[model samples]
Target: MLEHLDRMEAHLRELLEKEGGWLPFERFMHEALYAPGLGYYTAGSRKLATPTDSAGSSDFITAPELSPWFGATLSTPVADVLRDTNSLDVLEVGAGTGALAASLLPALAELGLPVNYYILEVSADLRERQQQTLAAWEPQVRWLDRLPERFRGCVLGNELLDAMPVRLFCWSQELEVLERGVVWHDHGWTWHDVPADSALSRIVRERMPPLPGYLSEVNLQAEGWMHGLGDWLEAGAALLIDYGFPQHEYYHPQRHRGTLMCHFRHQASDDPLKLVGLQDITAHIDFTAMADAAHASGLEVLGYTSQAAFLLDAGLLEHLQSLRESDAHAYVLQLNSVQKLIQESEMGELFKVLAVGREAAVPRGFRRDRLHSL
Candidate 1:
């Protein structure tokens, strides 16, 4: 890890020296995640995930680590999706540390839902580690490089859409989309406006309603991913859980710069260029655009709700009671996890949960009665 970091530092030094004193934020981000040797995710370094939590850990924490309650809540929806069917196959994208999978498998197992869990993880190191953590559930577990042609149960993703590469755009006063580009200028890396030539423009114009803003981020990759998921599902449903806002709030003129941030050792910062390949960069997902893509792909947007609402409807309290009555210490730990997930100031409000399904007999438990379709 240290060696790769050193090599990356040297490469960055050379690039900066030749071009300017700094690199564009995107370039820095690319190096951080995909750099050959020492970049955060791609590098041989152990920066992102490890056996134990230690100092200088990769930035950012997802709900899975917060508690088993989230997994319990997730199961309700999965079970609901698979209610009429006995055989269930779940494909989970980006199983960070495999926490959700670890918790969810047992929860569903208790519910008598025999599940074949398929984890599609991109990181080699994380995949190997996940194999060990999930070793006990051997017969039912299968690792995949991608989603299969047809699946019955559910395709679930948590905190995934935000990480997809996005195209930055600024809407001019004329309401035209202008592409944001990076250039080596003024002895440093700088941002400049360029003509929008990407195919994303057509989709954005057609699906994304006009917003009166010049500076914003566009996640074309996310839309593509949605289309792919819908196509691959072929039979079942897709559940996307991520931190984001509805269209109105996300594209409001007041936002100005859009949602983009970096996490380093649990500290959040604005400058993604500060520490290349050593931190996590993420943007808040735009749920509206995602739904639009799903609809276009022939998938019905079944429900969209806040994480809190989704969990409560899914019987979070029922699961909590069952655990609490079983053991006092375990109940306390579970409560702490629930608090992190449902509290107003935490992931509860910020994270939006959307479920898209095809030919489902009924709306899942998470979307049972009070679901608001967006």
Candidate 2:
């Protein structure tokens, strides 16, 4: 850990010297999270869950924590994809702690479908942890560094795109896409604001979704990744569960600051510049942009909705009933988990679920009636 910190410090110092004693926030973020052997994900002592945590350990929780039935619910729609494409394989990206995999794989096992599960994770430490947690099902699980050449199974990613480095831009009625650069002054690093550039400024002028618009975040990386993901699957579905807003909400004119955050030991912090590579850095996803990229890449956009709606359509309530009727105490625990996931004040509203594919017509897992599009 010490060595990693030293390496990161050197990198930061170098960045400070270049570009007139500063760096773009996106550059800082990339180096902080993904720099070889020195970034937060690459250097940490694994944050994944262990058997000791009762299948519920993490800095933050996800939908799968609600119940094993969450997997069973997801399978209902996934099974349809399999039937349509005549394939039962699955590709899961960024399977943190492998909790969802542990829950979903066993359920997929019993479905009697000829299945191959692939996990693509960038963190070596977390990959090792996933291997240990999922050792019992070696026959079904495979590790990958990147997406395969050709695939027909469902592609899954939860809270994955939000972590991709986003280029931050500040906008005004006159000036647009102002760069959020950092500069080293007398004592320490501070923000160095600059005028709008050619490419991003054009984006702000032509492509920006109707937003209130004082400042906003841009995830060009997310768009690029979605395009690649869509291109990889010959015929299948891509399921993404993440925290983000549609373009309209993302660029609300009154909104002066974008959603960029850092998490250290479950505590949320607004300062990404402080910790360097010690804390996790993330930004909110833009669902509209993701869908646009998928469409541009020849993938059909099926459905976009909130996590709550998707889970419910997939039968979260049914799972609750079955589990509750059998064991009241366990049912109560599961309900609590659902509360954190779907409550309007919680992740429910904050997290949006997007589904894209080639074979599936319109995914049945979302409450499509409620969606407002770009």
**Per-model TM against the reference:** 0.86, 0.90
Candidate RMSDs in Å, in order, are 3.7, 2.9
* Tens-digit per-residue lDDT, 1-374, candidate 1: 45555676677667757765545444555666766656666554444433246756656667876676788778887887877443488889988778889889999999898798999887777788779889999798899996677777788899878877677776666767667655556443457666565564664565455565656677777888898777877667778899988777787667777888888787888766556667777889888889888989988887888888788888889888887788879888667658878888998889888888787654454544324434
Q: Write down the TM-score for model 1.
A: 0.86
TM-score of 2: 0.90
lDDT of the structure predicted as candidate 1:
0.74
- Ten contiguous residues with the weakest lDDT in model 1: 365-374
True-vs-predicted CA distance for residue 371, candidate 1, Å: 7.2
Best by TM-score: 2
* Candidate 1 Cα errors over 4 Å, as ranges: 1-6, 9-31, 44-56, 172-176, 185-188, 198-213, 365-373
Q: After superposition, how far is residue 100 of candidate 1 from its true place, in Å?
A: 0.4
Model 2: residues with Cα > 4 Å off, grouped in runs: 1-6, 15-20, 46-58, 65-67, 172-176, 207-213
Q: Report the poorest 10 consecutive residues by lDDT, candidate 2.
A: 48-57
Backbone clash count, each prediction separately: 3, 4
Q: Give per-residue lDDT, candidate 2, residue 254.
A: 55
